[model samples]
Target: MASLVKKTKKPALQPLSFHSHPTMPPPPQTTLSTVLHLVLFLLLSSTTTAISTSQDTSDLEQDCTNKWIHIRDLPPQFNLDLLKNCSEYPLFDNFCSYLSNHGLGQKTYNDSHSWYRTDPFMLELIFHRRMLEYPCLTSDPNLANAIYLPYYAGLDSLKYLFGPAVNSSFLHGLDLFHYLAHQDSESIWHKNFGHDHFLVMARPAWDFCQPLSNDPPIFGTSLLELPEFYNVTMLTFEARAFPWQEIAIPYPTSFHPSNLALFEAWINRLRRTRRSTLMLFAAGGGISANPNVRRSIRLECDNSTNVSLNGSITMKYAKLCEFVDCSNGICEHDPIRFMKPMLQASFCLQPPGDTPTRRSTFDGILAGCIPVFFEELSAKKQYKWHLPEEKYEEFSVFIPKEEVVFKGLKILDVLMSIPRAEVRRMREKVLEMIPRVMYRKHGSSLGLRSKKDAFDIAIDGTLQRIKSRLEDSA
Candidate 1:
């Protein structure tokens, strides 16, 4: 039993196997340096991966910043569904069918975007079609910088208000709400609450904001007020203040030239012509909420009637809606005569309609006539996105609405006081501005193929705004 075994010497430390127990202890001191080296190697790899990821994200953002817009491929039903009943409204009944001709109605072959007045409701169609024809549109979401939501929210709501449905605004609104809410979980709008998304409409913002019980039934819904729409930007015909979510866009007009050459030719012809009238007031200021403002305008115009200013610009007046037949939601006057007043007048009166904005302002601009605004709300703050940032006095005349109303200030005198040379300069400015305000019959109206026109400017301006907002958030 005492014949026993021999003992061998053992080292104090040894390399540890990674395949040790779950709560493995530290490696032996002899292997500690190796463990530290391994840790450093892994850390470098992770850091490299992270830097690469950051670079990729930055590249994507920069690319988007340069004019990449992703259009949501919405279900066809969303666009075409309401279009079935589109013509139910009197003003826009023919517009839905005229999309093929660029909303030119039956006058598509008129060799120019003239003759027939373009219905204002053509906006929803125009903006949607513009995106389809734009250079910045991207089908791939990953490559997109901003998202476009082509909901036709204006036309969709207006049909109910102006159609036989009567107060059925909620019908389409509820449907739209559910449609947005039930989108695929991966939808960008679903997660971001549509912050990067935008929709353009021809209607005012008031139509989308739901009214109170005592509020006038404008046939609207709570779509804009809903929590889902808080982050989305709105391009509207007339954007009111307070929420500051909406921006004003110009109303649709009849002069949608196919090419810049043609547009320039038309403008040059107008510039060459002489304006015989100092100011022309075609609309009646007969009766409104504030009757005095309009009545005074009527009285001033009447007093100045048939009187030539400085023996060059005569003052003329007419009541458009009453004398002109606009029964079909468009005036049926001879195209030549209709535009004559605007074209002959050096400055055309642009008073407020139901809203602060008026299509007449744009009409006068297209006619190569400077706009004369009585209400600041009419054009001053309404078109900040589209107009030049120049002072109002440069392109328009602002005879204080109250001054003209109560004090009986002479509009003719105020206009005559400005030098005739200055008036010529103002007219030239309006001629240059024609392209910016007009929606072309074709996207390539200017010299460049697919040159940006009104539609392009509006969309691009909105995208720039969206980028700024995102940066602020970050």
Candidate 2:
């Protein structure tokens, strides 16, 4: 056995075989150089891929930036003149004051409040101002992908809407149509019969759609009824259900943040707010034609004049409800008086006002209060461009007006039945939607290119829609 044994000398270093060994010692210099080269190759490849990915992202952002739009230099009567002589409107006592602060109305909140007496119908002025400052605006129409008509159609309709010359409601709209007809044949108007063009309406679609049966002309015009306007896309506060060129936009709220920091601060304040009341109803009882709806809601919240003001709880299950009784219609434009109750309540009542749509729907969102809508058209059917249609329950509750008015189902009982954890989640969702519905102050030098507010969303959607149509036609 001793004679058969053979011994070999151990080398200074053993050769590393990556293929053979699960674990191997460090390689020699030559092999180490190869390994380094492999690593360097991988790193370079990875860097190339990274650069490519960055370039892709940058290209996407550039594409968005390149989605240029042109604003038709409309006559002053269309926009500027309307604002200059806003005094003539006489819709409000100080109608001209609403034109100040970029059409946000006089500052009701001087410093920290950031609120104004914004008229619900003042969106035309607000939108025009925002479009003027749009970053991608091109003066050359040939280079434009979409055209904006800054016509004060809403303001223009006011004179004819409520006036005696109801038959002449289509005068200004016809003037606009004639103005477009006179444009060069090669112009954008003729390119797609104004299909690539869009305008923002400060009123509901019904106000512009005057039917032949509309006797006494109860505040409506034939503007939308114009055949020439069929192709033009309209961004309205309240759009018709279907087959109309109207798209519903968020109603202008009193809280318009000047900058992103201010916006974030407001959001944080809402998140940290201590809600003391179970629910809030801050509108005028006189606003709704169906008196029973408001009466039922008021009675359920123990806010009816007899029960709330007299300090008598007639109901067995009366809850601490906040009411901003704008019985005289004073709180309609004043946000400071109305939003406080919303901030202190878990839910804000958004029953149908003069129309099914109310400015309070968006205001409740701004205050981070979950909205309690009584009508489908109130919030769910509208705001498809801004609100999550599928996730309505995430941020809102729907109680049919028929149930409350006829069946006598209690709103407080329904809202109180939801677990507190669910309420917190809903509130968070509501807070998350504040920015989308809010029309933040435009032309801020604060580099808010990334933060798309209501204006941004509407414009982007409009441009995209036009682009898709143009592409399909091409």
Candidate 3:
């Protein structure tokens, strides 16, 4: 009976409700608890969604841009106050003005009657000499100091008080003109003998025999002997002559088979001794024209000194891409590749090799790279003649050779901390200056054409120095 009854156990009695029993009013709610749970769930879900959205946006933005694009968008930092807006300076205008003003520029070549009358090259020498004397003309104090004191007063006097002395010194110091004459031995010997006989005869007696022990010859035999005699005589005397002066004027005494090497050695010595000066050696054809020069520059930059040599002043050479080669005819290599990286980098090392002024600095500026300069060695000094100490505060970073290693390390650290976007903007600013700052002597003439010359822009900061110096002296 028990087994038969257990097989049919009644299902648990369904709760009898008259109208679904009011659906068992959900378990009595704790208002606070319920509200808290709902809020927590919502916050968790929202946070997850927000994180996903942020990450997606970041990825998208990153995917759309690169370092170059950002750099290209930045603004330029060079001071343009001095430059005439990408146009060449009016040499003719300056010359005309000088002529009208009865300045040294008015002097004509070889009047034959006037003592001041001389070769055309002498005029250029005089002009350069005069330019170096006036503090106003020379933007930097160092350059002014480099000008010989005697040359300074003579050239700056407006009357060219030392023109005769300059001409005489040039004639005697440089030998190429006489060598080029190729006169008959009689004429050559007689002419030269008459003019230089005192020097020639005095040299052997003074140097070799030491005839006058009290006031021995001030210079060596090499200084007194003619070029033809240099090979013939064994006097072995070192000439104490300004290499540049000799090259500029040309004379028998100045002619040396090793003149080129001597000039290079002199330049090297100047660069080495004057650590404050930034040297720029520019050459065409990607520095292949003179690898030795390039090597020398590299040695100077990398090993000799750590002073703030402009990146453009380095002996290190980089082949620029074709796109940035403004010198369409002169620059044969592709400029874009070189420029692209330079624009990206903070410094563009430019060491001139063969060209008058290192073109690399302009390339660096075009690429938006700040030039690291050795002020004195760069031929650009012949034009701008001063370091833009203030204006360059924003765009360029200068370092003396002694501080290069330390300063370079510091700069790297600073650069790393800067945001990528900001760095790009800075570079872009530099690149933007190409049209305004760079000048192609042949393409756009010389100097700047628009408002001011590149020299003005470059020396804007130095102008402040002039003002300050003037004020201080006042």
Candidate 4:
């Protein structure tokens, strides 16, 4: 898969405090595009050898048909059956919804020229479909580098997690383990003890960890807890510290560029667009028991709004009590209503939600907005595969939640104190990250000038990890 790159053991990050150093001197001023150019130059140089001008599906298919990765074509019970009914996908008696525009959902927003608001939970469907378009896909296991288990484990487990009748009896989880147990030396599981195998899930690590642990006893399953999964890689939205490595991936956003032109247009637009709002927080509050600092930050944003600053600090959809229905990858496909605020904001406040990590972090970064993080684990501790091995302040703004709640620190002033040049530099860094953090719809070909995107990085990193692990064992 790859030669050698350290894939295990990520060093802990020193917590960054975005101090309101009013007298802080600005670093050397660099144009936003210059930073972009430097970053792209480094990346392009590294990947120039692998970047092909025309990697059409036909060539990739022919090349990989018997020499890349083999996909296990499971029965309807594994994948197809889950998608047969959109309503029952998350639950048996769920909402009846139709998927238009090839599972991206019908574009309800008027602004088709710029961006569209797509559902967040459709990642499982999107990824599974996109996997078919992967150049490394092969039907024959005989000529394969690794094996892909295209199981809708996240979708399948969602039923048990959100169902009305909950129990520890996860039939789907048990059934999968039983199937794996029956594998012989000819099976992919027998190939290096399933070290070269992987499966992608749209949900976080907690969804699968939960085994009806709540006092009221919400539905939870024990799928990942099974001993059989210890050797296999689990690709999830938020990677957990399990026996085997769990890879973190960006949540599926509305913007899935079909071509390089569209991708370039989006990045250029973000670079030139004038951000009217100083900071915006689009997260919901009062969703959990403690609700943590969300409620506090929401109040602060509400109190600090001003017309003169052109909506300096804004908060939207703060409480998500009614948002439980869409928790299982079944959200309204359109997200532009929420995305507009992100597009207009200079900095987006991203606090720790149910977990330290939030999908909105990627959304804010993709929208070219500098993110303000409260916790180290949100992006710093997590996303080792996607984020750089450097301090969090390089691409994001970090202020401890205590300062906003008790220390009486003004987030707006703190962020505004940052030099304009530094802000542009950070925003440019965020824009430069678009290609790496986003998942392009790589149908048939990786498209023209396909700069290494989130999909490319994730796959390449996982492959190298496997190779490194196998070699160490050897």
Per-candidate TM-score against the hidden true structure:
0.77, 0.80, 0.26, 0.75
lDDT string, candidate 1, 175-258, tens digits: 655666686556676655666778876688777776434244565665666666677888888887665578888987766656
Better of 1 and 3 by TM-score: 1
**lDDT for each candidate structure:** 0.61, 0.70, 0.28, 0.60
Across 1-474, the per-residue lDDT of candidate 3 in tens digits comes to 000001112111111011112232322212333334433443353334324433324554453221100000001111111111111223211122121101122211111111111112112222222222222322221222111111111112111112222222312322322432353233433332221111111111112221123233332222223443331111111112222111111101100111223222322322222121222223333424343334433434344333443454344323211122233322212232243344334455543333323445655564345565544334223322222324454555444332433333332223234444554465555544443343211112222233232323423323333334334434
Q: Give the TM-score of candidate 2.
A: 0.80
RMSD of 1: 26.5
Better of 2 and 3 by lDDT: 2
| Cα RMSD to the true fold for all candidates | 26.5, 21.8, 36.0, 14.2
User: Residue 70's C-alpha lDDT in candidate 3?
Assistant: 6
Span of 10 residues, lowest total lDDT, candidate 4: 10-19
Candidate 4: Cα lDDT at 207: 66
What TM-score would you give candidate 3 relative to the actual structure?
Answer: 0.26
344: Cα error in model 2, Å: 0.6
On the 0 to 100 scale, the lDDT of residue 48 in model 4 is: 35
Q: Tens digits of per-residue lDDT for model 2 on 1-474?
A: 000001123111221011122143321112333334433443353334324433335545586464777777666566655554454445533356466555776655333334566787788878876765565665567767888888888877767854445467756488788777785555568878887899988989988888645556556887887888887889998987774688888998877666555566567667777787778888877334554788887676664323332222223224456777877766665555666667778888989867899888888888888999998898788888799699898899999999999998878768767777999999999988887898877555464456778998998788887887777767
